[model samples]
Target: MFCQLNKTKKRWRSMFTVVLTCPKEQEKCKLPPEVCWHIGASISNGSWLSQFLSVFLTDLKIDQIVTFLPLPPRALPLQELVDELYNFRDCYFETHGVEEAGRKQSDVAKEIEKTLKKLEEKEDHFKHKAEFLLQKGRCLNVAPDFSAVAEECLSRAVKLEPGLVDGWNTLGEQYWKKGDLIGAKNCFTGALQQSKNKVSLRNLSMVLRQLPAADSAAHAKQVMESVDMARQAVQLDVTDGTSWYILGNANVSLFFSCGQNPQLSQQALSAYAQSEKVDRAASCYPELHFNRSTLFQYEEMFSSALGGYSRAAELDPGWEEPLEREKQLLEYLRKVTELLQNKGKVKARRLRTMLSNLSTSALGPCSSPEFRSPTGRVGSLEPRTLSSLTQGHNAGVAALGKVVFSLASEGRMAFTFGMVDSEETCIVVMVYNTADSWGVLIGDSVVIPEPQVKRNSITHKDESFDFRSIRVDSPLLLIVNGKKQNVQSQLAASVSYKPLSE
Candidate 1:
């Protein structure tokens, strides 16, 4: 005989109810009231169920019956479930390169939710619930549209386990993402109180740079401290590219705030170079490229600047700052090139008069008779034309020119102007750390001593410009209209804040 079974176990007392009629009495007969059988089991020849049914059927002198049903799922061990969840989380964190990590974060989040739910039901007995909570918080921290919940979870985790360093760091990062700098700073500080990890140190360094200070001195101190913290983090792990990148940023901050020192710029560049060498994955970071580009742009290394900006833009398409900077730089170059190209047509007569009127006697202390040329000639200390300036620093030489066009200041830290010598050779002059009130007009004479020349040939997108430029790190080195300039004031450093990642 064949029979069907009901799938619902809770609603039905037995697998199924069967009714049969006796052959002689013509009356209905019922089988056993209770029959227990698991789903997904087949009754076949030689099977246990088949054997049991065969014996029972033989007692009643009945034929054989066969059936198949679904099986119930077995309960998974709690430890095994936690282990699986941790493995998945580890895979997500260890996967380098966001693009290649094809795992869906939403699915991971769902799994985390499921585990959390299980842990919560056994909260009174679970010993490692706080750790899993931290994992869930971290997973939510990176997942999209989960910041609020991530913060809540992270807060709960830290509350449950005050000594959890990772929880504090992650909570700090969450606050950073929300633009709560003070909260972020506090969380990082809390993490440091528990441990001296590089992540917290580097993150604290970044946050310190953005924090406001009481005065210029305090600001300078804060920036220096930030640099020091970053250095410490780098020392902790020399191979950490993220730490190196933060060090570079801190140095850049020092460069701008502490008088636009070229040495500081060089230090920042060195840090960036070290970062790239030790960590190839650093190339995947957009902010590193962008900040490096900023330094290059400041130094008038146009080609390298353009390349960095381009790479940064490619790395993060959602970020518009790189694109804007690239456009502004190209436009600036185009304008500068046009101005230089038209110098002859627009101010030829005035430029000639100014050049003729230029005198070495007006250079005062700058016009030294003991000054020796690059060739070590004593008598050749006289002013040379812009065309005579070779690539790199023209040591022991002075150049006199008439300013023909003044480009607008960039970041209010550098003053750029175009100038032409007696030979009508035009070049760009960039003076750093100059006050906003200081102005170099169109017809003023500019005398530069030991001018540092940089040749730039940049071709970016649909724009191209070629020019030679001079970088003057200090205004005290410049003589305008035969009078030596003094450093009365300097533009304050303009620091930028952005979300950073490791």
Candidate 2:
């Protein structure tokens, strides 16, 4: 004798809403079986929500609503559901709002503050003391007083417990804050030796990131070993916050060394996300935001990149990288908009006016450095004249369908792929190895990425052309070992080119 379907129906009676099925709204519904019908809507991704609802609804005093159901539904008498729901709701709201606000930059300072308070509260606990000290030292630029206190605390902890792995890590962090790279590196090494903790491994990797090129090979070796050790740490404790942070950072370094593989960038993002979740209050938010910004930039989501960098800047205002990136994003966005505008388009016209104002604002007052001409001579060249000419040239290039692609083939540093066009000849400049390595590759038969996007014409305001150019698109592939030390060897591969029909 199987239980009847009526039991399942009764179980759902109180849980479901029947707004239209109520007696007051009966005339609005013409369908059969209307008495029990419900405009049943529960939240999507119902796995977490169902359990949450199960708990929350138990405490809800909808007695009349519950009375509509039969006795089989009486299994809703669990107290655990109520407690879990309260906690889950609190956490869900906080995290969701934080993510939606995209205010992850302030997370570092906030977390550091919380950690400091916790450390002070548990001053006698050696592990907590060391962690607090280390985190405080890392965040010293914001509050230098914390750094002094952190160092003193770690020094005392080390004296009390010579083999404490975290004490050594805290010591390393203090050295790092003071710009003593070598000392920091040695301290991290000592910490790693004392303890095989993921946090220590990550600290070691961070110290290695500061090493010079001559020392980078050794750093890379250590990083790989640390990664292997971190993998084990992750396996041992999946919820370890420090382990995931280390893994994310390790992958970032690997990507920077191996060249810009989007997949690797994404992997790094996922690891960072996991780390952020393992401990929402971790002090690595700035790094996470910066890395994620770089990923957005790679994906050509310039607006998102700008937002991420802006957040990173908020987290660590003195960090120049994100600031520079934010400036670049604004400039690129403006340039892209101008190149795409059609004549008499109201929005485009508005954007142009906005961009004009931005350019003017960027120049600032005459005495300010932002406005001061790069050229020292006052009468020799009008700065705005030069700027206007450069802007015009760039705008023309963009309008002519040339997309600037930042390329990073494996084992290669990032480089600009653009064309050098003068009156007589046009040549592709494969600036290999470094930013200044501009090798003129004279060619018309170059293999451009397929199915190029059409761009507007520079001559006629309303006219657009279906054409391909090098200055407008992002890179496509991540070919390993594509980085050659010298471009001279590939000189024979280029052929001379004449300007195409406009």
Which one is best on TM-score? 1
For all predicted structures, in order, the TM-scores are 0.71, 0.46
Candidate 1 residue 346 Cα shift, in angstroms, is 2.2
Which residue segments of model 1 deviate by more than 4 Å? 1-128, 143-146, 260-263, 368-381, 409-413, 461-463, 492-494, 499-502
* Sliding window of 10 residues with minimal summed lDDT for model 2: 493-502
Per-residue CA lDDT of model 1 for 1-502, tens digit only, reads 3334343446434554333323432223334312222322324224554554445456666553433222244334455566667556544434534553334455567777887677566546654567767766765554433388779877988999999998999899889888888999999999999989998999999999888899989989999999999999999999988889899999998988887777999999999999888877676677888998888887777888888988877666667888788777777787778878887354556666777886777565566666443345564345787888899988777888888888873333367788888788888888776777787887888888778898888887776778888988767667788777765844554557565532
Provide the overall lDDT of each model, using Cα atoms, as 2-decimal numbers.
0.73, 0.44
Clashing pairs in 2: 402-471, 402-472, 403-471, 403-472, 403-473, 404-471, 404-472, 442-495
Score residue 76 of candidate 2 by CA lDDT: 19
Question: By TM-score, how accurate is candidate 2?
Answer: 0.46
lDDT per residue as tens, model 2, 288-402: 6666666555544445666777776665555677777676655544433433233112243443443333222221132233321222322211122211223112321111112
